[model samples]
Target chain A: METFSVIFQLLLALSILVVLHELGHFIPARIFKIRVEKFYLFFNPWFSLFKYKKGDTEYGIGWLPLGGFVKIAGMIDESMDTDQMKQPAKPDEFRSKPAWQRLIVMIGGVIVNILLAFFLYAMIAFVWGKDYVKNEDHIHGIEVLTPTLVGDNLFQNGDKIISIEDEPLSELMQANNKMLINQAKNYTIERNGELVNITIQDEGIDYMLKKESIVFIPRVPTQIDSVMPTGIAQELGLKKGDQIQQINGMDVSMFDQFRKELTTMKENNLDSFDLVVNRNGQELAFSSRFDTTYKLGFQNVFFLTHDFKKTHISYSLGQAIPEGIALAQTTLMDYVNQFKLIFTKKEAVKKVGGFGTIARIFPTTWDWKIFWSRTAFLSVVLAFMNILPIPALDGGHVMFLIYEMISGRPPSDKFLEKAQMFGFFILLFVMLYANGNDFYRWFTGQ
Target chain B: MAYYIGVGIAVVIIAFFMAATQKARGYNFWRYFIVSIVVVAGIYMMIENLVLNPK
Candidate 1:
């Protein structure tokens, strides 16, 4: 059910974003009196779901769900409206516009996306504010899952997380994860209320980079919180408030211990477990079969309830605009840096993802906060992507305009065509590769 | 957040100046400024990530 809802929300979010993006271009073209031949919510090559001709525009929904486009008259875009270009240029056409006007029409969509992202962010901020977890509040420090150790090898459970390197853990962990991402090495913590020092390597910091993941807590009680009616737990008579203490004669002191033992059962193909529970201080025993993985009737907190602490950020409307703009700028810069790292052999950019990763970002249910946050983040992503000085994008068009403004002469149409085609292929390849990464992960169950 | 926030502030300034002075010819001050900002920020983020990370 969760997966189904996630897929549904993903489709809705993508559709809305793509449509608004195309509309951003469409509205400007109409305002500038340019003839819009086709206004589509997605690319329609072979067929379309719906199309209507009205006032020089054929509005429709396309079959392809990847992206959308607005076909302007006499414009050389993905639409390949070459036949219109071959004819005499009309006054109300994109090719016949002033350089400045044409530039806006080309970049109008990008501007709209950026603005839309900002507005969404502001609304989300006003509505839900912001929530974050302090590293110190983890109580249980991060567990090292890697097979190798690079730190001053005293890493162990129950170690009090004091600081990364020498920085205060609370301040660093308080903000938008800048601390963890920015500083990925060194350590200062208190073990048994005594300060200790350790040096950790940056090689395994990617795990922490995942924006959302479940962090397990050791020595926690294993009370059955709830159960799905048709779930394995329900079928096994698991009830809320049942305190599970032992599993298959293993004295489980914590929920984590129970999980670790259950994972080992997979090797033996044991899909069932004997659960010892203390119901109202009376010891009880039962058997339950595992479903999917080895998940049992352990209580799990709702996402919103999982972290109780609040990180409130207040900014006036006057302040938030600039703040919002700044947020976009920084995100754009970070994206550019990541891209440069990939190009310069500094970091692996192949990890950059497409749809599957985007879908993965959504929570199991329809949480407006999560939706808007992811949407705003993607908006920034789109803004950064379109601003790249590649030939097929707005940045590419901007590059041409800048060159024309400087040299007082546009590049020859033949050269422009070749460059555009080259750029188109490059973008196409990138989209395919990114989306292919999603497919690969899904197929391999990674 | 602070590091990224600083970068955000810098980008806005660069964009504003670039858009404001786009018509003028000669030297391309805005372009140089943007490039410098990116370089400086890039180096800063890298160093901060490597040397001064909070444990």
Candidate 2:
């Protein structure tokens, strides 16, 4: 059922983007008097699920959900319509159009993708507003992931991240981006009632990306908020407001730390362990055996009980337009920055995911806010990817068209055909490699 | 054990597709066959180290 929802959302988002992207080309081609042979929502190799012809254009939905296309007359695209290209150029065909017109036609899809991103973001802002936790609101500091903290001693278990370099950290959400994008030299943190500076290393950034781990999260005390009547905690007489202090004589103050200690106990083959909890200013000890699933069977204190507060920024319809554009600009820039890491950092390639990873991002139960945000982000990604100067992509055609406009000589049709084939193979290789990584990860339960 | 079997199957399928592509594109069979093996091996090693066998 969860898988079904993910697949549904992925398909729905892709279909919307594909249709809009094709319309970007179809509209301009029609205005410029270029004949459009087909406008498809997906690739139809041998047959389409549904199709209809109207006024020199066949509108259809293809069975393959990979992507869609608008086939302009006399255009040598993925369709590889070389037979028609060999014939004399018709006045209404794409080949007979001026260089500028052809360039616009080629770039139309990318333009529409960007515009769709901006529109979605604007609508989202107007409807839901932006909500994020401020850095200062993390009164309990941060609970560093054990692996990350142990691997790199730059951060302690309860360290408050004050600033990256000299800039004050404003939003908790922006910390990782600021660190990665700026490549900060120093991290200032409030630790053990004193300010300390930790030198940032490029290797640390690489490690985080390689591991795909959140280095640290906001720390909250492990206080019992609820206990099941038939659970082990209730059986042991544990009540609400009891602060867990230690497990088996090992210090475990935070909820995550307590959980980690239990995991370590299970790994050590310990069936029973002692837990010390502070109740009403008095320390008390209790012993309990792990259940079959290795759980204590109690709920920890919720984060809302802490001082953390979410700051919301609402906008009027008029205000949303500029804010939305600004959001889109930052989103595109951030994506490009991250994309560059894939090439520079050797381990970054492992982070590249296929359909499985994409599906996991969607909530099992649908939420419109998350769906719109993911769709907007995917739109930006699609726009950037299609604009790469690789043959068989929109960017490749635009690159050639620009060259022709500048040099006053178009590359031969045969050369274009070969380039298209080469580009197709390169894309195929990348797709297989990415999907193979997904398969390997899933099969190994990574 | 499963990793080895999966890679073996992938190599066979990739080789078959590589052959089909080479035939369709009128390229030398042996040249692309070797290239396909190298590419597949490289991808497999990468997945092992970066993903499956990460420290």
- The docking quality of candidate 1, as DockQ, is 0.02
Residue-level lDDT for A98 in candidate 2: 93
Weakest lDDT window of 10 consecutive positions for candidate 2 chain A: A144-153
lDDT of each: 0.65, 0.80
Clashing residue pairs in candidate 2, if any?
A: none
The list of candidate 2 runs beyond 4 A from truth reads A146-153, A180-183, A225-232, A245-253, A256-296, A301-307, B1-55
True contacts kept of each: 0.00, 0.00
What candidate 1 gets wrong by more than 4 Å, as runs, is A1-4, A46-48, A147-156, A159-183, A186-199, A206-341, A344-350, B1-55
Top model number, TM-score:
2
Candidate 1, A172-277: lDDT as tens digits: 2332233233434566766777888876554343443342222222223456667766666777777777777898899763555666777788767887788888
TM-scores of the models, in the given order? 0.65, 0.82
Residue pairs in clash, model 1: A163-B55, A164-B54, A164-B55, A182-B49, A183-B53
